[model samples]
Target chain A: MTIWQRLRHTLRHGPAPLPAAAPSAETAAALAARLDAAAQRRLGRSLAIRHVGAGGCDGCELELRALNGIVYDLERFGLRFVTSPRHADILLATGPLTRTMAEALARTHAAMGEPKWVVAVGDCAIDGGVFKGSYACLGGITTLPVDLVIRGCPPTPWQVLEGLRALIEANATPAR
Target chain B: MSAAAAIIRAGAASGQRPWPRHALSRERWQAMAAALDAADAPSLQGVWAEAERVHALFLDAGSPLAASVEVDGGSYPALSPHCPAASWFERMIHDLFGHTAEGGRDARGWLDHGAWATAAPLGPRQAALPPRVGAPEPPEFLPVEGEDLNQIGLGPVAGAIAEPAHLRLTAQGETLVRLEVRLGYAHKGTLGLMRGTPPRAAARFAARLSGSATVAHGLAYAHAVEAALGVAPPPRAVALRAVMAELERIRAHLDAAAAILAEAGAAFLETRFGWHREAMHEAAGRAFGHRLMMDAVAPGGLATDLAADGAAAIRAALAALAAELPDLVRRLDRSASLGAGIGRIAPDLALRFGASGPVGRASRRASGHGGDARLVPGYPPYPVLGLDVPTRAEGDVAARLRVRLDELPESARLLRALLEALPDGTIATALPAASGEGLGVAESSRGTVWHWVRIEGGLVAAAFARDPDWLHWPLLEAAMRNGMLADLPLCAASFGLTSSGVDL
Candidate 1:
């Protein structure tokens, strides 16, 4: 199990294959259908997302990590999380919006180009979830206009992927 | 004896027994802090405020006993001047409760960002007011000295999959001179929200305090409440709690390994470790109902039970992990290029911060402060089965990584022991809504996590949960001193400090 052995094994086996747990063709097409004709034309097939953790408990962060792993492999669906909001078509936000992060969230969303969409990703983001009346949190992201809401204390990776696919379809270019 | 233990012995030697509600004059409180610093107690556990007084909680690394000192007023002389370990705790007390540590060194806001509706949100009659009055002023950070040092602020919004923390690094060329971490971006008013809520419901806030260590926090919160009510969970519940806790520990270590590997640029190894962690989560989900096992460890007992089928599945998962981990570790260790920049931490710096968990263990291996929650007296199942603790003396990134790898098999062994001897009985006991105070401690994946609670009239009056990061984060600055800037990520990842854990 040494590095030499690992290199040997890599030489013998080659690189690992792309993950097999991709979204079904029907699911992809349906997601594409959700996009309006004009929006879809503008966005095309690829979607870049910028994630902002407003004031979360870290459950959603863990789930988001899972989506990138081999089990979910979110990149296969033409969706990728970019580091900068300017490079993103969607802002995928998690957590109850703490007042401290409200300005930052707004700035991030504002940085996204025109036709940018904001998707609230967890129960906390959709409303307040358990953190609902805390003085620290403003419940959801009240500072920005939100387009999509995905609810769960922390939605599972599959659920997160489904939400992403839906966002793509909703903004996808319509067929002729 | 260790310095901390000696301090406790000497402090208590006068024979005036200091109980839970031990009152001290301002002078006595200041003198005690100075004495403990001179005697070298590990860290101040927490500093909190009640109706009209401020209290400081202290723990000796070598003993289970906790000492509390109360001074009547909104301010007391700060302990940070002599004992650097109490620095953040004092600032936090000032921020949250408006209690001043009169002569504390750091005056920066530890939790408050001026975004709140009011100053001192937890101060007398302040909770009812909204936390936002107008626009918040930008937070201030201390500037690093020297003309050569250039500052870089990393986050509050990071690239991906990270809790919100502003890591302000002061580097001279490519060498780091200082690392100042600003948290509270994820502070959800957890303690404030817990007040007035019944223990059963307030337990969720504890679990959510840091999702990665949910079971430990949940169990600790439960223990605090049970202690206050003067009740012990049924034997079956205690055993079941142990199962969930151990499983959590295993999963967290796997995740930490994956993070460390990713930082080391071992892409394939990182993914493999992450996959292993995912398998553990899947098994946990099948057995319990949540991936993080959230809400499963509730006050008084478990929220659910582990069925026979679930037990078998968990056993199979552990077997798979046990079989796959060694090969992975051996491959990771033998990679020569990855060994060059593994960060190094000094034992004295770690001791000064009262570091715990893997970070502390790797610093001074023979120190025997392993952050074992099972070490706390009166905890069941663990004492009988015993703990298989691991330590590495190098105090470098590689040493910390090795400590985690060593723990994987040890945790697996603990899980197997618990599963084989599954106790049969009621999984939960009803807790009465009563008034009292208690401290609950648990060894989470990160390290020893403690929750202190005071319940009154069937509602939580006050609560404090300490993440081991409180000790480790300060030490990180020292660890990074004069080290290459490129090694910062790996060093931070190796420590596995959490923002929400401390920010809360």
Candidate 2:
């Protein structure tokens, strides 16, 4: 159909229906409860994340970007990506920690405020994944004190969310 | 014929496919560098180096040819003085291979930022040293001389969920005078890792070269491997490959549109575009096993055939997108903020960099100089099924977006056609243990992705995968000149260059 017809059809029909809720919604209630308890306890119901890429292929970043889409709606959980490490409550690090980016990643982690968590995302961030044993890489994010690890060549957005939920649940103090 | 192609044709052919690779003497290689000074010179596509030789790929007219010169006494004649596009590649070649470009314009290090344990890690074994100690030294940026100009350093780690790269912007007030991009922060030693491994084992590295262009990279690497072994994949595999490529292009364009809209502060529009992108990803996941389809296009053929109901899932997703795309595009065209002619790239600039894909099409739209690998190098299915190459004469951010918008429907159409005529046959063919050099080219979302591979006894002896971003990154720096600093992100999103793609 011509663009005009498509526009007219849209005007008459309002708009196409939004796709059904993603498969991740099946575990939404459990994840929301866990996120709520942890966020309320330590983060004032909000978590600011700073992403540090340390030389792995950008596959992890792609999945991370998906979290902000309408379906994932990451901010609705009070989780947001921030620009500066100083403003971040958690450092979401990816890549195999290549030597070139090692110092920068270290500085970024050092710059973050206390009570911050380092959540290593992707197998490369855990132990270099496919890039293991390369001369230029340091294997993984060994310089930082990692609090949680999300495993996958690149974990799906759902898996990342589950990993973050677990991070909060493990650290947040129980209500008296 | 272009001087470079003439020289390439005269040399001994080395059995590369789609295009030929020729071994040239030192004198002839120097002559090719001199020939680039002519007004009608072929564009320099890429420059890479191995332990004993350095190679240069060039585009003459619409076809590609490569020439390699043996590195005697550890140096080769520099092409950067004549062709500015070769400057970065020359620097990278020196850094990685430790081969000097004698009389080269820029002698500074490209990828080595002092954090590495050794110098010239990919160079000869004797030259490799033990790991260095302490913090890495800062990279030096070119000096900008002018009155009342201050410099601002942006990254190495900047923006939200973006790969790391340092940007040094020298500005007078709000207008950027010079924007220098310092990359290599995302370098993962991909080439070094690929060496000594079988093509099948090393295909994963190519697929991951750029996450957004995984299918394109994978397809190109698979083609290179197939060419080297003199094996042809089943017809069904070839058609399926095209299907995945078009899907990836459609999804990536949607993501680029969303980013541009988001930068323009069109929240509702941005979300709508993101919604479409999410649907595409879902469709890909349902069709293939992976959301990104990483490692799906393996050497020989495919890792697996399409899942049951894959075609139905893909058709549903396309129908949904088709219903919404026109209205969304109309809304975008009507938005004054998005339509403003910001980030204009001249056609000459695009041609000089050998830009391809949407960015090249948008810039060279009026000139009709843009060439898609699918059409030029002539791949199967694409040549028969045909493609509608979209273009926009404006060469600005809006023009780029319009080109992308125009491409979405065409891709949807192509996908539908491909799915309808889905070939029925064995999905894969066994590859034989053989050795040769081959070049594989694929038109990716960002631009053309070229993978050059040399196999020896069924193992990858040397490999270089050049993403179109190597050219587009330089174009981004050029386009940002004299523009408002605030528009940098918007302009970059429109170009859609990836840092990790070239950081390898």
Candidate 3:
């Protein structure tokens, strides 16, 4: 297909109007400040991330992996994914929340330490993309509080990197 | 031609205290228990609960054939033998339906820990309760430990990635001693999702269970429904299914090749492989309507048939891939670092686990189950065309890569063959509703994926989809021994085991 055709396809199937794209919560300057501070004290902001499967085709996982690859390189910013909920600084949930996994999600979120962030990545993670409730879905990460939502059936690697960058940026910002 | 006869002979050779195939229900179940008691079958392959009964398939150590036994749900809660693999499925049956395998030990549940109001899933003729939130108390994860073994835990989260599973790897200074895997972080009750979703809709759900094996799941689900209804898919549909399977195979192999490069630290090679995989996915999306082929196949036929333009595009993409893969593999073979980075394990491990797909093939096991034999009902036109079976002897991770490398070209060749002769006929029209229990199996890229479905008067009674992961996960544990800790990721990538596929 030609480039124009590809663009048209995206226009036709792309996610619902971005809902104002959730205005950036923090500026680059603030993000830089926190990074420098973390570096100075030798105590970088520790992020214990939780991966939630709301309802998705795992393409989100692949793109998310791409962001962590050598190309996008997420570790450089000192953010890391964690196993235990008690240790989490962010719950990086995916998929559209299903009825069965709902309790696990709620408990996992409640288990996280203070100053938590929930970022829903992917169209399904945001609003149950391809699997919009035939029988199993309860809907997106909104089943719980979501600090950020990235849209796309499975967002691109760049978008994944951007969303994480926003989370760190937002964390450093003073609540308005 | 006689799957039943082949199974009986293979069973006796495997030393299963054999029961004649025509034995009645009680007679067969009792005989199977006796065989297991006699240590004739070393492993219980799997079990499925349909209607009010549960059937168990068993195989003796190194046996080529398998035997099955069916017992009353009430009787089962007490009579089944203590086979490890059978344990999970039994517990699953109990959790969903309320039936127990008699004398089944541990009694610990799989995932349904009294979370739902419904009775055990298979015990009830129809579903009773609404979806529930939590299993009673989460089962205590069996902590893995030994003298002075440093434990490094990975996942549930490692970054922004969405794959969910908490892996506890116990090792002594990077040499892994034990791997206790905790799966189901993403288990959304997909099997449960299939309970009544018309097979057409259910196939879509199955397709999404694992992104990589979408086509496999789609075909397997379709096949189960087809068999349940006893309707053979059309000739064109069969031809198309083969083409799609081959396409899925080559695409996955390309991804595996790229992953091998990534593990070997060959940056350029890795990128080349990644691009190829993307190109394949794109081509697939254009041809089959879903990049992953989700919802393509339906009961007795196809939901969507291949269009001429789509077929032409797929052929073109395949031609390009076929041309490029040779040079790419040649580079990998010549790279000393990559060759050294391949798995260093023994073939014995792969054998012990009965690993399937490229892993089994690399360990020198037959990779392809003769397709023509599986087309028993002649639904797909597979009997008309043959498939290439890839094999290797090293059984190491590198051997797995080599198997994939060889298979990649073969898949492309298959694509060309299928496309050149793409049949012109109805994909499928319809079939009568299933009147009894039936079994359906598809040769997925990984290996044979089976779906056992029971239809009672036209509605789905139960659907049990089991992928090759049953054999794959165990082999992964076997492969990890004696490798350096960093190499663990490389090892896993080489195998690319899917937890979602396994958990279901």
Task: Please rank every candidate by lDDT, starting with the best.
Answer: 2, 1, 3
Question: Per-residue alpha-carbon lDDT of model 1 for A1-176, expressed as tens digits?
Answer: 44466569879986543344444456555445544433444577699889999988889988898788766677878888899888988898999998788878888888889877778889999888999999889998777877677788789887788777766655553565
lDDT of 2 by residue, A14-127 (tens): 665433333343244444465455463455557899999888788899889988677787876668999999999999999999888888898999999876778889999999
Tell me the TM-score of chain B in each candidate.
0.93, 0.97, 0.83
Report, for all candidates in order, the number of backbone clashes: 11, 1, 23
> Candidate 3 at residue A113, lDDT?
71
CAPRI-wise, candidate 1 is medium
**Candidate 1 stretches greater than 4 Å from native:** A1-41, A173-176, B1-21, B39-42, B68-73, B125-134, B336-341, B365-368, B376-378
The true-structure Cα RMSD of candidate 3 reads 8.3
lDDT of each: 0.78, 0.85, 0.62
A-chain TM-score, model 2: 0.75
Between prediction 1 and prediction 3, the one with superior lDDT is 1
In candidate 1 the C-alpha lDDT for residue B337 amounts to 51
Q: In model 1, how large is the Cα lDDT of residue A149?
A: 74
Worst 10-residue stretch by lDDT in candidate 2 chain B? B125-134
Tens digits of per-residue lDDT for model 1, B245-283: 888888888889888888888888888888778888888
Model 3: per-residue Cα lDDT over B61-119, one tens digit each: 32323344444635563334534445556666666556667777647665543433444
True contacts kept of each: 0.70, 0.78, 0.22
